[model samples]
Target: METNGTELRISGVLGRLEAVLERENSLIGTDARFDITASNAQKSRCLYELNLLMKSMEPSDLPRAAGDRLIRLRSVVETNATRVKAHMEAVRDVTDLINEAVQAAEADGTYSMDTFRPAAQ
Candidate 1:
C-alpha cells in the first residue's frame, strides 16, 4: 500500500511523541511533589490523543463516529475527576474531625495517642 507524504509526516510526529512520553516514565505513583503530576500527565495525554484523532479525520467523517467517541471520552474523564474529588473531600473531612477531637482532648491537659485508640475486645 502507498501513502501520501503528508500522512506519513503526521504518523511520524505522533509516533515520536508517544515514544518520548513512554520514556519519561510515570510521575504519579509515589512522587513527593506538591502537585499531582501523574494525573496531569494522564490528562494531557488524553487531550492530546483526542486532538490528534480529530485532526487526522476527514471533515465528513467527523459527524458520527469521532464526535461520539470524543463525547464519551470527555464524559468519562469528568466523572472520574468528580469521584476523585468527592473521595478526597471525604477524607479531608474525616481528618478534620480527628484533629478537632485531638485538640479538644489536649485542651483538658490529659490528651494522648492512647485516647484515640480503639478499645480492646
Candidate 2:
C-alpha cells in the first residue's frame, strides 16, 4: 500500500514523541544533572503537534504502521509516567524532610514550661 502524506506526517510526529519520551525516561533515574524543563517542553510540543494531526484524521484512516507506532508510543509513555511519579515522590520526600528540619530548628522552645505546668484550680 502506498503511504500518503498524512501517514508520513503521523509517523514523523509519533517518532518525535517516542524519542522525547525515551530520552526523558533515560534521564529520570540518572545521577547526572539534566534540564528536565527543556525535556518536558519538547515532549509537550511533540504531543501538541501530534494531537493536532490526529484531530484532522479519522481512526479508520490511520495507516497500519501508524497504529503500531501508537502502540509503541503508549508503552513508552506509560513507562515515563511511572518513572516521573517515582521521581516526584522522591522530591516530595526530600522536601518534607527539609521542612521538618527547618521547623525543628526554628522552634525556640520558649513555652516548654507550659506543657509541664498544671492548670490552676
Number of the top TM-score candidate = 2
Clashes per candidate (backbone, < 3 Å): 0, 0
Per-model lDDT: 0.55, 0.84
Q: Any runs in candidate 1 off by more than 4 Å, and if so which?
A: 1-37, 48-64, 111-121
- Model 2, span 66-117: residue lDDT tens: 9988887888989999999999899899999999877775576654666669
| Sequence-dependent TM-score of model 1 | 0.43
Residue 66 displacement in candidate 1 (angstroms): 2.8
True-structure Cα RMSD, model 2:
6.0
How far does residue 107 in candidate 1 sit from its true spot (Å)? Answer: 1.0
For model 2, what is the error of residue 24's alpha carbon versus the real structure, in angstroms, after optimal superposition?
0.9
